[model samples]
Target chain A: MSSDHSHLPSETELRAKALESLLVEKGLVKPEALDAIIETYQDKVGPRNGAHLVALAWTDAEFRQRLLADASAAAAEMGYFGRQGEHLKAVENTPEIHNLVVCTLCSCYPWTVLGLPPVWYKSAPYRSRAVSEPRSVLAEFGAELPEEVRIRVWDSTSEMRYLVVPMRPAGTEDWSVEQLQRLVTRNAMIGVEQALAPERLAP
Target chain B: MRGGHDLGGRQGFGPVNPEPESEEPIFHDEWERRVFALTMATGMLGQWNIDQSRHARERQHPVAYLEQSYYENWLAGTEKLLIETGLISEGELRSGAATEKCGKELRIPDAEAARKILTSGGPAAREIENPPRFAAGNEVIVKRRHTLRHTRAPDYAQGCRGLVREHHGAHIFPDANCDGEPVAHHLYSVEFPSRELWGGGAEPFDVLIDLWEPYLTLVDGNGE
Candidate 1:
């Protein structure tokens, strides 16, 4: 090990390294294995999967009905069942109502589809306020809902995960599933924001 | 115990500084990846179950639990579990050096196995012979519980009146599963109107929570 006396490894960094090395020496885990796990979450699983589901639903009314009726089976049909995704409930966004998802207890997200939750979704501000002052919180995300639109906040306190099937932007009816998927942002799925408008998507 | 991990309605936090989707990386730094991967790999050992893993993270002191960054908390819990389970010693965890050669009794998931297990991912819902006590549209009240231990029910949803939106079948009850045994119980998606939870003049909205059967009692009336 080379000397870096000028800046000792931070306690947090040191602790992480210590744990990894300890596991390896004990023959309990391989470093390569850890790398693989990280890679799986980093690239393999993410919002893209959820995007695919949303796009499919937009193009197919039957699939949309199935998604809202039984999100778990619908995801399974698309081969999207896994950790944090075993149980899923797709809440659709209509013109008259808005839906948002939050986990006040912890960041319990649909990993198989949405991948790992974003930093803000797991942060204290979003968690504490989402259930109470949701309009204010949504405003922060640039999602302003009218007073007439009812707000339904889903607080994930159990194994059940939620995905907001954001409304397809007005001009997206003729668009392809891939085109619609391009507008499905992670925030839209979490209910913090809505699906990107047609104009927002680069032409 | 009633730890600080529950952030339902307590106030005074600042802006939710969300990063731009294009700019935000999954793991902020190299160390985050290490901690995340370490937690996943160690968890696959099967020496501990998912509920126990959650309790480990939520069991931290209130101050530490609330203040620590997400990954920092994961490291704290991982360290605690390693020591408590006899997989890694306290001194060894601090020094990054192995002393006693334990953990032989544990199962190690290799790279391929790790991938498979995570993809297959453990599902908590288990089939139970007992029928669900409540059904959709049934009025129910969440009983207040002050147990100072691991609980899946949030403090905000407790002591409030709600209606059953859906029954999620039987799932492992966290309070009982803290010891790594699968105990399935009926879980329901209870929807509490904002007024019922926080009083009048509040945002006219509804909050839905997935609660186990034990935490709820059937309300005979339309609701007080």
Candidate 2:
């Protein structure tokens, strides 16, 4: 019964508040459950989960073989299989090919491993231009591949979500999983950029 | 439907300027989180599937679809689903009050229960005894037909020729799922050269899209 409407929230906020209140009042939705759902995505699930798998693949050759062979089963090993990530297909970025993922129809992303998608991933520009001008798109993200390397753009038009396994950086052979994980950014898994270079992580 | 959401290869969008991964916030604002949670929680009621929820948002006008923020689109879709499914009346939404009880029994999950369900994740992949229509490496053409309803087939890929990269097994047909009918069909990752989709001058790249069987046909040598 907090009736402090003095702040004058926006229409969107007011509507959201009203909808939440109505659902709670009708006993159709639990506020605690709603908080739990938000907290789960916000805190628990994220690109770090994908990063962990990436780091493992970089370090362990057997795990990398399993991951490339069957991504969903491999992800299940790390307990990262659910929701949008039910049918994940990892596309490895070798020296000859670069992979990029985009959901042109909508922002259909692998929420289980990568959490919620970024604003740019869901934006119209990325969706429209990713397939048509992938080289330019990659360049925009500061990832410039040479002309000889072929680019493969995965358009997520169905239930399948693509996870780009970025090429392991050079001079990181001795780095621990913890240190390697720190170098992995969310964009790297999405193929917008490569993993943080060893020199870049000096700070 | 050739809605604004079908944005692949078509131009005019400026650039893909992404925020640094470290600085990005999970929810841009409090309302976005609430709308997202509301969509998930209400979605758990089993009134509709994920495709139906997407169709609700797709049903919006092209301009409105482009203009609204991501969560705003979610709210719009949630509002539409609430009314369409008889979970809430339009009057209740406008007045910010529940006028009558929902006719159907709605079970609300507690925090722990919700977490378990979410973590478990309902997968749409179905097992079918029938053999797939097309195999990997087969060149196929996307069927060129527009239905005025929910369909996962992107307009950009329609009527375009592509090679089937792999058969992804049977999956819930989104068109049928959106229409409240659960049907399974063979899904394949079809790879079309960038030139085939956007013509010459485009980079030498292959755009791979997962297309269901119904939306594709065998490409005869005569180019029919």
Candidate 3:
């Protein structure tokens, strides 16, 4: 049917009408059923798993080596990688230069380790300027890059997802794995913020 | 029924929010709100507003609750509309669906699901099929293409001087002339002296833009 009619349906009206017709024909959508199914998988495979793997890597040098080299296999070994994990790649940030990621076109991310991408990552200002003026972009988030250090901007245009393995923060020298995991927020992995320190999180 | 990830800012067709800090308007149904949040978490902010008269027609027409399933169908339809509009492509739309499905399956909260879909695998992992025409360290020029459609390349960079820094692989080709094919193209890091992008005493070596291959051409020392 043509949408050229003078009177158009309100989104709410269309939704009500649409739902009314579909349910009449096919029955209830089992909305809660869908949610339960989603809950099972998330519990089974999600960011929490990715976080655990990151914690393991932080403690083990060998694990870190393998993680940076072949992230998918390494993550899979820990039971974190799955359907979307096949193309997962890990980028480690060092003191000299920092790596930041953006989809520019869309928010293509690695869900297993880093969790979900934020509103800003998929924003036009972030996408358009992040690659061109990364330093400035970082500055907006309060992340300043040294002039001497070249900023490497990764523009994710395909299925290849990225995670920023933030530098282990200073003064957290002896923090336990569980404690350290608290510092690894999703924003830190996006290069928008630095890894947290014990002092920063003190209540 | 717009593409989930097509935020209004990128399109440049709408005015900035009247109240930037206020919470955005939410859908009537909680599930609908969940879907909206999930879409935004991955940074797909586009939505379908009901055409005014149709909204009235629906109220007057009256329908069953079960037909609400059409809201989901409406979402699917909107995604197709975005693909045709060049706001996104089949690949992007498909991945968005995958994320939506995954979000539903995993029960991950909408914000969390959005983040997962945006940062995790989908188009982010797939390799750009075709390498860019240029290479890093090489001087290139951005091409000027004007249309009413949405594009990743900015207008300021058109016909401007830039140096290719690196080549990122191909993805969903946004150029409509190519007919919505997911062609391989390079994600070239093009350097634009701040002066070129924004006039006045800008930083010397500071340049910008990680442009796709289709946007560039070789610019020799004499300049193209």
Candidate 4:
């Protein structure tokens, strides 16, 4: 993944480097702290954490009850509570009702579970269109729900972050939590798309 | 204020061209990561709350706000916060050096402490003895006033009537909290029908938004 751009850093890159050096020199921020925050989001916390919770909800009925009842507490039970997810509200997708989440004002995502939000989530197009034309937006993601099913869009205006527990696809009854987790994509958890079907997972 | 950041329900923006989830990278480049980290680290300084940081970003001109990328907006917001809080002067920032040290004693968290603090997040919910003005099943209208500062009420819901779906207990009101006047208010999940917001062409659906008490007013009778 290395490129021959060692001598040609972008202007933003230069400014960031300059800011980091200044902050460090001023003792306002530590270099190690910066790396830790990046690493925490990059490696430790991610969609895999959310996938674990979704898989558990699919397999364990009692856990699903707790997750739906109070998402933050249930997330803490699984050791997945933190910044950007202080007040998580899990909205499950059912056959009759579809749930979609978007931060109209800003990208208020569940970073503790979903890690840093995708570029599109913060983009102008997604922010404006998600609330106005959710169905069309989901269609762009190739998520086409039935016409009869009611769509409920959750606009995250406050500190409350939303997590969409996608419905379990057909033909995955006997699958283990690990196997089911492989089917849960970050987009599905964000309610842009549905969880992968069993056939799609096959090579 | 009707800032560029609040872009819900308004039109003229084009289609949402989303990248395939399987292929999208977390950070498009190294600088994006750096900007993100810097924002979070400086935010930990406790000089400004999240709402204030958001207001800083929204304070930019509409054209600039729309043109700037996500991390670019974040970097801009960080610069505003630093200057506003007296942590660094514009001259110092321009020089890329510390001209004068901040007089106030600021507690800067180290990497380990930041990790711990991030893991155990700070919740905005507060324990207030005041009762909620609206309850579930009650019809309420979103106040139509616009303020030129930090506000949690989105423009799309302004003047729209919705049903109170749930009472979310007391939480720090962003409008007051951002102004350095911290006050607790009951937040509720208001459910507005799509037709109510978008008119006849809208699909049969409901949009739920969490609104603080001050942003709402109860309907007199007949559910409006």
**C-alpha local distance difference test of each model:** 0.87, 0.88, 0.51, 0.87
Q: Ranking under lDDT, best-scoring first?
A: 2, 4, 1, 3
Candidate 1: lDDT of A113?
92
Candidate 3 wrongly placed segments (more than 4 Å): A1-33, A36-57, A61-77, A80-89, A103-106, A120-160, B1-29, B32-133, B148-151, B154-180, B186-196, B199-211, B221-224
After superposing candidate 1, which stretches have Cα over 4 Å from the reference? A1-9, B221-224
Ranking by TM-score: 2, 4, 1, 3
lDDT of 3 by residue, B41-113 (tens): 2123222211211121122111231123323433444444434444344654433322212112222234354
Better of 2 and 3 by DockQ: 2
Question: Which CAPRI level is candidate 3?
Answer: incorrect
- Which lDDT tens digits does candidate 2 get at residues A15-87? 9999999988888899999999999999999988999999999999999999998888999999997778888
lDDT of 3 by residue, A1-203 (tens): 11111233466445434432332222222333334334534344445565566667788899999988878878878766543456666778787767776765455567666544443454445655664556666666666666776555555643456777877878777878887887775667766667767677756
Fnat by candidate, in order: 0.80, 0.86, 0.04, 0.73
For candidate 2 chain A, the 10 contiguous residues with the lowest summed lDDT are: A1-10
Model 1 - which docking category?
medium
Model 4: lDDT equals 0.87
lDDT score, residue B155, model 4?
95
